[model samples]
Each structure stands twice: as C-alpha cells, then as structure tokens.
Target: MPVTEPIRVGRDTKEELRRLKVHPRETYDDVIRRLIDVYRKCQQ
Candidate 1:
C-alpha cells in the first residue's frame, strides 16, 4: 500500500469539502481531482 501523510484543514474548510463531495463515501482525493477537472475545463 502507498504511504499517506496527514493533512490539516480548518473546521469550516472541512465542512465545505464534505458538502462538495458527489457522494458521502467519496474520498478527499476524489473530490480534489474532480474540482481540478472542472477548473481545467473552465480555463480552456
């Protein structure tokens, strides 16, 4: 398994991420990747 490091976020920030998730079970990595894809599409 790949090593993972802990990341810290403020309470409000964490809440925002929870709301942004497509599904309750989605990981933070998935949410971030999806946001990046949307941003790249907008930039084009």
Candidate 2:
C-alpha cells in the first residue's frame, strides 16, 4: 500500500470529522472513498 501523508483539515471540519468518529488511525482516503461511493450513487 502506498502511504500518504496525513490530511490537514480545517478546525471546523476537524470537529465535524471527530463527531463522525474519524480518528487519527483512519486515513482521509477511507473517508473520501465512502464519499465517492455516495456521490456515484447520486449521479446514477
């Protein structure tokens, strides 16, 4: 697996992410992948 650097999110966004249970152990890629799936479904 290609290791990517941590994603820097804005303070407001970081709080929302934490509320959503995305922690340091989770990669931004995981978040983006889920978003993409929902986006693709919406497009369809």
Candidate 2 clashes: the total is 0
Please, what are the lDDT tens digits per residue for candidate 2 over residues 1-44? Answer: 79677777899986766565466777556767777888999999
Clashing pairs in 2: none
Task: Flag regions of model 2 displaced more than 4 Å.
Answer: 5-7, 22-25
* lDDT of the structure predicted as candidate 1: 0.90
RMSD of each: 1.3, 3.0
Q: What is the C-alpha lDDT of each candidate?
A: 0.90, 0.73
Query: What are the models' TM-scores?
Result: 0.77, 0.51
Q: List the residue pairs that clash in candidate 1.
A: none
Task: Score candidate 2 by lDDT.
Answer: 0.73
The per-residue C-alpha lDDT of model 1 at residue 20 equals: 97
User: Which stretches of candidate 1 lie above 4 Å from their native place?
Assistant: none
Q: Which ten residues in a row have the lowest lDDT in candidate 1?
A: 1-10
Instruction: Specify the highest-lDDT model's number.
Output: 1
